[model samples]
Target: MNTSTSGTTKNYRVLLVGDEDNSARLILNTLHKVGLECRYAVGAAAGLSAFRENNIHLVLLDLSTPTAETLCARIRENSTKPLLMTTAATDHQVPLIGLKVGADDYLLKPLDPPMLIARVFALLRRVYVYGGDESHVAKAPPSYSDQGSRLPEGWATCEACNYMGPSPRFEGRSRHGQSVMVCPHCRVPAAVTYAVS
Candidate 1:
């Protein structure tokens, strides 16, 4: 079954693909509480159709979905929005496979409300507000050196989303390699600078 339910406003939209009635209802309820609109589809065909027909900001998929991978690939072809997958299986490989195929994040279900909200917020923060860009400037801790110089600290601000964080993101070499600290709310790569009073 395919159903598109009207939500509060157009500020955000979600495409949910699954056949599990209880899980879908729980998710839809959570999304509605936060003022997000959702469109639900029971299988891959409906999911693909809805995705193409709507202006969706994120996709929440069930790993048990038939042709889950194919559906993800099809969605990725046109949209850059975040895709999150959930699974009931405990096997460690399931989430990995979802990530390998195209999912931006994976979750094990019997859904935890707080975790679900947090992940959704994080994804929405990055995709909708930041669009995966590092152009925004943020404040940094004075003790932190960025490119050898101590940057002035104040706050990292995203003009597009009005997101503010305590520290600007910084780039550094980790054991694994170089990694940049991104704003949790906007995903902007920030610089390490001293906080300005």
Candidate 2:
């Protein structure tokens, strides 16, 4: 598990979106037992409704949830919180798509209960904390900070590798293109190409 301090003490409101009653209950139980605050919705609409009232810090979505992609898009437009998608054993692409849609992590099904728990903890920590990935980003010389090019608001920039992995973005338009962009240090590109995403 990636341990960090930023969000550790803050109470994060999490939205659990899934149709399976048993699985939701199990996850809810585990989170509560471990002392994490959360709210759960049975379907897509309900999940959005819950998000409307709660300051949700992260989302836990079942891969099979109806309207999953649309829901992800909606959430992506609104927040930069970490999204954790739950995928079944046969779905190899779920994780990939989840990230593309702005999910921060994914849990494979036939779920190893402990793994899911760890992911949630790590994600929440990152969202509220500044130092996990920022330790590297902060090391960058001020010259590296983009002045003309806009970065999606919170997208992290790694100074050591200069790789801007991922983060929440600013609203409306900015200097950044809002892609899953990489900084110059992630990997050197061929002279003909630019490291946009």
Candidate 3:
């Protein structure tokens, strides 16, 4: 899975919260294959502490952990970062409650590595790449904008045609709910910007 866009690879950090060390290791190995860095926490307290102390970009929570729900809710209160949950329980309500408490996605354990990787990538793309929330981007240094660029802050330079203008000039959304900016000059989806409230 090449997670790069526009020839740049994002160094996204993931936090794995669970008591199951073997499961956590498995997940870390899978994510590492695609260039994601991960941190592991054995319980809710440790998870919360790690989340606060580190520059975590996303979270993978094992719902079977006794305190998973509490950790999930607390993390949601602190940040809008994507949270993916996994559990072995077949009870549908377990996942339902997890979502209600703020998980972005849930999976059943005896986990499928491919599906897990896909979901992680999807959430990262939606929230960090195409979603374009300034809060998330602010943590990472500017990758596109550079000191030599004449474009003003909040302006976008089209990747396809070099059309430069305020982000609104290229504003639009994709059918999948991604916030995309289409280049008016070349009719290509060119950029993503934080939507002003």
Candidate 4:
């Protein structure tokens, strides 16, 4: 488990969407036991309503819902939070469909409590716990130099994955298309700019 430092405590809110009574109860109990705040809705309309009205950190959905794809699309339209889909369907194409609709992960039913918690932790770590692009973009240090377009060679660290190593050979573009350098270890943007030293 990742521990937050002083002044970094976070309140993680999960929006769970599913109609299965037993599964929903288990998930709710497990998440609460682990100290995460969660809200549950039995249908797509209620789920979307809850999500829009609250600050949800993650979304857990049951693929068995008739409107799962549409709900996923609607949620993705507004939030970039991690979305996970779970189903007991044996059809091989179900997981693929979930991914296409913007699910970050798809899991089968009879979910393991430890693994479920771990996956949730991993998602939270990537998006909020660690210094990801979302948290560091605004606070990025100024560009090293303005005279040259070429990046300097040196050791760099990935704030997203906390990987310290030599930088990659090429610069990568951000989601907004700005050229940025990424860490060789985890491939997350290392710095928005670099300079020859």
Candidate 5:
């Protein structure tokens, strides 16, 4: 299903890091069904470089890739973007280690497409749609009241400080020139159309 908010079309970029071409193709195909643009990196180094060079909203790291743990740690150190680890190994410790290294979630290999899509969507919703705070219900921006173009008050959460409360409507432009809502509390750009195509 398309995850865009009502009355808005948002895009997100996903980085798939792995050495297995077949697995990458499968994962990319699954994600594309839901409108996410994906980039594939062959190994840890390439993955790290691609992530650094692009606006990657999420990362899917394959445990089979060499030095995947190091890549996870490196990515986590650099950004708060969501990371998911996939593996064929059933050892419980593998997922634990992946989590310890900063994966937000993990899945087994021979991947189930539906479950994969669900997890990816859930993470994107939690981070971008809800501004990283799950407690608040999403509300559409207030429409112009009878005052002729005057917008009613609105609420926003600062992705930096976790601040959530009411404020006047604050709008800005993203690096990609997309209109976004700025966080009043910290003056940081808070929400935007998330797709990166």
Candidate 6:
């Protein structure tokens, strides 16, 4: 079920796709405490629908999700938001497959609430704040690189690789910031600086 952020502004919206009622409940409580609104779906199809219908921020998936890869693919088609997956304790082998299918991180089942919140915060920091093109620490997560990012209006993409950084939306002058769109990894200007015909 979806609810507007009433008491406090909902910082993040999460979708958990699986049948783990207990885990889902725990996650919901943790997320709400941190100003994140988390909603769960029982299966893959419902999960996809919920994701599409709402303004979701992050996604937590259970490896046992029906059509897990398919669900991931569908979500990736529209948004580049972070996706974290949880697998059984002995399922170290699953992250490889999960990554290939577009999942960003994987954790063992029986969610550790603290660690889960940390990962979610980290993921949100990277996705919501860090520009998509950012790769290096200064331009991405591990650091505070707000220099080249369009920041919290226009889209800025690194010319070097597939990395992209999305600016948070706000009203006012379209010129949110400089955001030269440079490569975070190489620290080089994003576009060609040389003369062109």
Highest-scoring model, TM-score: 1
Per-residue alpha-carbon lDDT of model 6 for 30-133, expressed as tens digits? 66665566778878888899888876778988878779888988889887888999888485666788888799998887787756765775687667665453
Per-residue CA lDDT of model 5 for 48-92, tens digit only, reads 988898677889999889999999999988798889999999789
Query: For each candidate, what is the lDDT?
Result: 0.67, 0.60, 0.71, 0.66, 0.68, 0.62
Residue clash pairs of candidate 4:
none
Candidate 1 ranges beyond 4 A from true positions: 132-197
Supply candidate 2's per-residue lDDT for 144. 22
Ranking by lDDT: 3, 5, 1, 4, 6, 2
Query: Per-residue alpha-carbon lDDT of model 1 for 1-197, expressed as tens digits?
Result: 76666544444667899986788999888666655667899999989888888867789999898999889888878766789999998989888888887899988889976467557756776664456432321221111121132223454433333444454443334567776554454455453222466
**lDDT digits (tens) for residues 1-197 of candidate 2:** 11112222335566788885687778777665444566888778887777767767678988688887778888889777788988784767767887788778888776766456557755654555433433312232111232223333344444443334333311122246553433343333221112234
lDDT score at residue 21, model 1, on the 0-100 scale:
77
Listed in order, each prediction's TM-score against the native is 0.66, 0.60, 0.64, 0.63, 0.62, 0.62
Backbone clashes for every candidate come to 10, 5, 0, 0, 3, 9
Off by over 4 Å in 5: 1-10, 132-197
Q: Residue 78's C-alpha lDDT in candidate 1? A: 70
TM-score of 1: 0.66
Number of residue pairs clashing in candidate 1, backbone atoms closer than 3 angstroms, sequence gap of 3 or more or interchain: 10
- Kindly give the stretch of ten consecutive residues in candidate 4 with the minimal lDDT sum: 1-10
Any residue pairs clashing in model 5, and if so which? 11-194, 11-195, 12-195
CA-RMSD of model 4: 12.2
